[model samples]
Each structure stands twice: as structure tokens, then as C-alpha cells.
Target: MNFTLHQLQVFLKVSETKSITKAAEELFLTQPAVSIQLKNFQDQFDIPLTEVVGRQLYVTDFGQEIAFAAQAIIDQVNAINYKLAAYKGQLSGRLKIASVSTGKYVIPFFLSGFLRGNPQIELKLDVTNKAQVVRSLVDNEIDFALVSILPDKVPVHAVPLMENRLVLVAGRDFQPPLGVSGIEIFQYITLIYRESGSGTRLAMEGFLNDHKVPIKKMLVLTSNEAVKQAVMAGLGCSIMPVIGIKNELKQGDLKVIEVKGLPICTYWNLIYLKSKRLSPVAEAFLSYLDREKNTVIEQNFQ
Candidate 1:
């Protein structure tokens, strides 16, 4: 069977997006054109590459193998292009970075300069929960995983960029009930928490457990922004990282509730698999992070 690299590229793009229309748009081709190429590629094979079920594209078992092989070829070709650019001391290639959702506050500041400096590099960022970010790291899907809490089971290298300070916060109208004990405070107010997979949630629970304070009658929100909004509406008090609340705190839309043993501190890390080799772009990014992390955090967080 003979097929062009273009066919494989289209197939991989389709696999990635799970939508032919999206793949066509990404490849700058019309939907009909993409469909024609897909048909031609299928004509060369007996097994089905993909199927549609319930309005969603699902790759067949054989299609997965084909996609994997296609990805390998694409990666090798990209590696060649990166090496060619490297000979000229330029950076060009795909850089996929995964981070926990809360990283939105910090990663952009850390990346702005590096991204501006390496304009040729194509950047893809995945912002999700901590579990997903760590899974991406372990699966070798991302070049860097920016996370606050590292997975204990995963053997990886973690570079600490800055401190993640978790502080108790409430709506402007609420007063800090820093009286009696931590347990007593929990008894008086409803606690708001980030969803289960969140790094912030994990840190909060760990801190509470260490102090033997039990959480009950709590509200859980999927994202930090949502939680902030909920707290600003005076739904409940929450433990949130200072990095995410700077603007709110400054504007007095939200205020920190000084609890007796609060402001749990943790490190934000730029993590990657220890066994996976870094590409030139990834290596350059690591160096750039090392050189600029302190200054960037100081300028943004300090």
C-alpha cells in the first residue's frame, strides 16, 4: 500500500481532534478535500481506521495502531526539522506543556518572555486538573508539566519555581473568626473547596488532616475561578492560593481570613519524566525557566 506523508498527517490530525471538520480547518483544507484524502487513504487499507458512534469519532483498534505509527513518523520528521533549525541556532518545533488549571495565573508570566523570544516554536498548552497533568507527564505526552503537587508514585524530575501559598479567604463582608481552635472555626462556617483532583484541594485536605480538623457541609467547585466567584458571593469560606487571588485581594472583592494555622505553603514545580529525553526546544525552555523563574515570580508574585 502506498500513501503520502500528507495522508498520515491528515489522519493523525483527525485522530487528535476527533472531528474531520476541525482537522480540515487545522490543515487549512476544505471539509470535502479532507474527506477525499481520507477516502483515498482508506482505499489502500482493508480495516477501518475510524468509526462514528453517537456523533463522536472513535478510532478502531487497528486505527489506534496506525495512528501510533503515524505519530512516530511525524515525530521523527519534526525532530529532523528541529535539528535543522538547531544547526542554524534557531528554535522551531512543537512544544506541548500541560499544567494544572490554577497554573494559568503563573505559567503565562513565566512563558511570555520565552515565547516572545522563540516565536517560531509552535506552542500547545493543556490546562486541566493535577491528575491529568501528571498523567500526561507519565505518558510522555507533554514536554513539561507545571504542577503544585507532584505525584509520589511517578519517577520524575521536578524543578521548583516558586511558593504556592494557600490562604483562607472569604467575602469582603465576612470577618475572620480566628478565635478558639481550628476545629471550632470549621464548625461555625461552611467550607468551600476545589474539586477532588485539584492540587489546591489536596493541599487543603492534607493541611486540615494534619491539624485534625474535619470538613463537612462543604461546596466543591470545578475550577479556581469558579470557587473564587462563589466565595465572592459569600457562599462560604475557602482555602485558595494567593497567586490566584491577588487581583481580588487588591480590589477588596475578597479578603484573606487570618486563621490560626493557615496559609499552607507548597512549591510549584515544572516537572517532566526523568527517563524521557528532552528536545532542543524543551531543553532551551528548561534553561530559560531556570534563568528567569526567580525574577519572574518576584516581579509577578512578590
Candidate 2:
């Protein structure tokens, strides 16, 4: 209750960047100054906000909870300023949005079109994996989130934006077994998988679990591009979003497996805190998403 906005801002930046040094550089402050500010803020509460693991600083669970509240406070304050400025006939403000890695392929296209019509608005986009996206949303660091999988317990409102079908893709040179049904294709090749905490990974795991596919020898990677490259190199096969492999498919660099009862299509949702009041810029962006959701999905997917 007694924290200053500057302290909250510093905390948010550090949490987002995961480094006090990097956060200080971004905020144009010295590292020691940033550390002092963070220490001062942490002293107000009984529990420590950050924990050091080896050389890295990580936000503790308690810290994360406080950070979430801090973000809401910051957002509300900005919303008030935006409202006052809007009454004075200024419709200019920055909107920050975080999205899952796959969303990078789709959100920018929609954002470009939206920006064309509203030149006064500025956008700050953070492209990361699903876990980071959820964390940012929960912390109020992002105004909205676009992700493939929704968390079980979210303090936010989420709306289904589009349904994505996962596809099994392989290099052009890799040959799938002949005279086999789609469900049987899994027996022919080693599976390449995404790292833990990935939405795509979670969806694929759920699908395999439902189908009872044994996955003891699958190779795991941290990036979609890396998975694609590995597939192209004939390292292994992977299940990926069709959107991520559109160009590869078009170029014949990869081929989608024709599998029946596979892929387990999932919905990508747009998420925002349920109780937080949105600023005009954030509200306009949300409206744009609602209006153009179908069009964007069709244009990108089909």
C-alpha cells in the first residue's frame, strides 16, 4: 500500500527482463541505483521479492503475487492519465502486448493492419513462449495476451480467438511409412518435441496421452525454428502449428502428415485481467481483435 510508482516500475522491468543490469540499461539508470531501489521496495514487506539462483535473479512466488498487484496498480494509474488526456482530445498512447511464439507469425499481420488505420497509437510487442506470456499477463505487464493454451487458474478474462490444428511435419526427404493409416504413422519415425512449458508441447502431450502413444525416445528442443531446422535436416519429425510451417510447406521443404484422429486441434485465446479496467488504447485494440478475429484467422490459416 505504501509502494511508490517508480519502485513498481523498476520491479516490473526487472521481473520482465530477469536481470537488474539489463533493466537498468533499459531504464537509463545505473545498476547500483536499480538494485538500491529494488532493495528499498523489498524492505517494505517481510518476505524477499527475489531469489538468486547461481548467477541469475528470479522472482519468488510471493514476489510474483506482489508483482501482479503492482502491475494492476500501474495499469490503472496509466488508464486514469489516458482518460484525462482523451477528454482533452488526445488519443495517443502506447499499448503493450505479449504473445506466444507462434503468435509472432500471426499477430503482427493483424497489428500492421490495425496500425494503418490508427497512426496515433504506438505498439510494444513482446514475443516469447507460452509460459512467459502467461506470467506477463498475470503480472499486468502486458495489456493482453494471445496464446494457444490457457492456464488452469487465471485471474483474467479470456476469449477464444481461433482454433489451431496441430500438424505432423517432416523434411521433404523423410519418407513416411506406406500403406498405413494416419494414426499408425507414429510408429515409423522418432518424434521431435518442443521444450517444457510450451503450449504446443502441452497440447501435443495431451494428444499423445489420449491416444496412448509411447514417447520414451523423443527429442526435445526449445524453439519452433529449431524444430523446423531439425526436421529440414532430417533429424526427426515434429508436430507443429500449420501457421509456423506454411512457407516450408509451400516451398516443399516440409510435408504435413495425413493423419486421421491426430493433431488434436486447440483454441488460442485472447486474455486480459477480468477486474482491471482497460485504457482507451487497450480497449480499441481489443475491439479491433474482436472485429477482425475471423478475418485474420481466415487470411492466415486458410
Candidate 3:
């Protein structure tokens, strides 16, 4: 099978994302183009590269081996690019990073500064749920993941980047009684929550379990933006990151409703699989984040 490097890259990306649509978006190509190329690549081999199960795409066992080989090739090419750029005294390579929905509020600033400083380095950012971010970590799909709750089973090195606090907030019409127990707070108001796989939801659940609050009525939304909108519309109160609600707070669209042991405080962790090997660009970005994240967060978030 005579496959070009582009084809290998397409295959690897599709495998990593498990979605041709997402792979196309990442590759800056149309869905049909990606599908055509993948079909051609698959046609040359005897084994099926992938299969769809329950409307979800999955790589076959043979495809897994092919993906590993393709990654090795890609890594070597990146290494060569890194070495050549270093020879010219510059950093250049692609960086893939995934972050939880809440981190989406602030991670762009971090990337913007880095991009201005390293114009040659490319970035692909995916703002998704905690579950997808964790899967990305496990599959080595990204160089870094910004999340508050790291999966316990994933062997990852997590570095604290910024403060993340989930607070109970309500619109002007919905008055919440503050200075109450965590248990009482839920009883008094209809709680809006992010999806189950979200870090915000997980944190809220942990707090509820700790306080022995019963699982009660909730309005679950799929995104932080959705929850924010729902809160602003006075549909219900929600627990969300302070970073996400800065504008709402300043614009007087929402107000913080305090509860005892509330606003579950957690640190935003920049994590990657412990066994994953980072490219020069990834390493440089990590160093840059380590050195500048706190300052950037302080300036942008506050």
C-alpha cells in the first residue's frame, strides 16, 4: 500500500479523536474529504481499519497497531522539525491540548501569549468535558489537559495552574438564602448542573455526598455556557466556576449565594500521562505554562 504522509496523519488523527468529523475539523478539511482519503487508505489494506458500533467509531485491533506505527513516524518527523528549528534558535511544532469546559474561559489567554511569543508553533485546542479530557490523557491524544478533577486510574503528573471554585449563583429573580448548610441550600432552590461527565458536576456531587444531601431535582445542561444562560434566565440556580461567571457577576446578571463549605475550591491541574513522551514544542509550552500560568491567571481571571 502506497500511502502518503498526509494519509498517515489523517489516519492517526481520526484514530485519536474517534470521529471523522472532529478529525476533519482538526485537519482543516471537510468531512467528505477526510472520509474519502480514509476510505482510499483502508481499501489498500486487507483488514478493516475501523468499525462503527452503536453510532460510535472505533479503531480495530489492526488499526491500533497501524496508529502506533503512524505515530512513531509522526513523532520522528516532529523531532526532525524540532531539531532544525532549534538549530535556527527557535521553537516550532504543533501542540495539541484539551481542557475541561470551565477552563475554556481562561486557557485562551494562556495560548494567545504563547502564540505571540512563538509564532511558528501551531496549536490545536479542544474544550470538552472531563470525561473526554481524561480519555485524551489516557490515549496520549494531547500534550496537555487543563482540568480540576483528574481520573484516579490515569497515571498522570498534575501541576497546579490556577484556582477553580464552583459557586452557587442565581439570577436576580431567584433569591437564595445564604448562611445555610450545604444540605439546606439544595432544598431551598432548584439546582441547575452541568452534565454528569463535567468536573463541575463531579465536584458538586462530591460535596453533596459529603454533606449527605439527597439526590434531588436538578436541571442538567450540557455546557457551562448553557448553565450560565439558564441561570440568567432564572430557570434555576447553578454551581459553576467563578471564571465562567465573571461577566454575569459584573453585569449584575447573577449574584453569588453563599452556602456553608460552599464554592467547592479546587486547583486547576495541567496534566499529561506520566508515560507520555513530550516533543520539544510540548516541553517548551509546558515550561512556558509553568513559568507564566499563575501570572496570566491573576491578570486575566481577576
Kindly list the per-residue Cα lDDT of model 2 for residues 1-302, writing each as its tens digit.
48789999999999888999999998899999999999989999899899999999999999899889888998788778766767778675778889888888767877877788776676888888898888898888888888888787887788787777789888999876678657777777889999898998998888888888766458999989999999999998989998788899999999988776666688777788897789888888788988987887778666
Write out the backbone clash pairs for model 3. none
lDDT for model 3 comes to 0.87
User: What TM-score do all the candidates reach, one by one?
Assistant: 0.79, 0.71, 0.74
In order of TM-score, best first, we have 1, 3, 2
Best by TM-score: 1
Which candidate's lDDT is highest? 1
Provide the lowest-lDDT 10-residue window in model 2. Answer: 176-185
Error of 3 at 140 (Å): 1.5
After superposition, the stretches of candidate 3 with alpha carbons farther than 4 Å from their true spots are: 1-84, 176-183
Is 2 or 3 the stronger prediction by lDDT?
3
- Any residue pairs clashing in model 2, and if so which? none
Candidate 3 to truth, TM: 0.74
**lDDT (tens digit, per residue) of candidate 3 on 206-298:** 888888876557888999999999989988888788988888899999998877878799988888888989988888888888789878877
Error of 3 at 1 (Å): 15
lDDT of 3 at 35: 96
Clashes of each: 0, 0, 0
Worst 10 residues of 3 by lDDT: 174-183
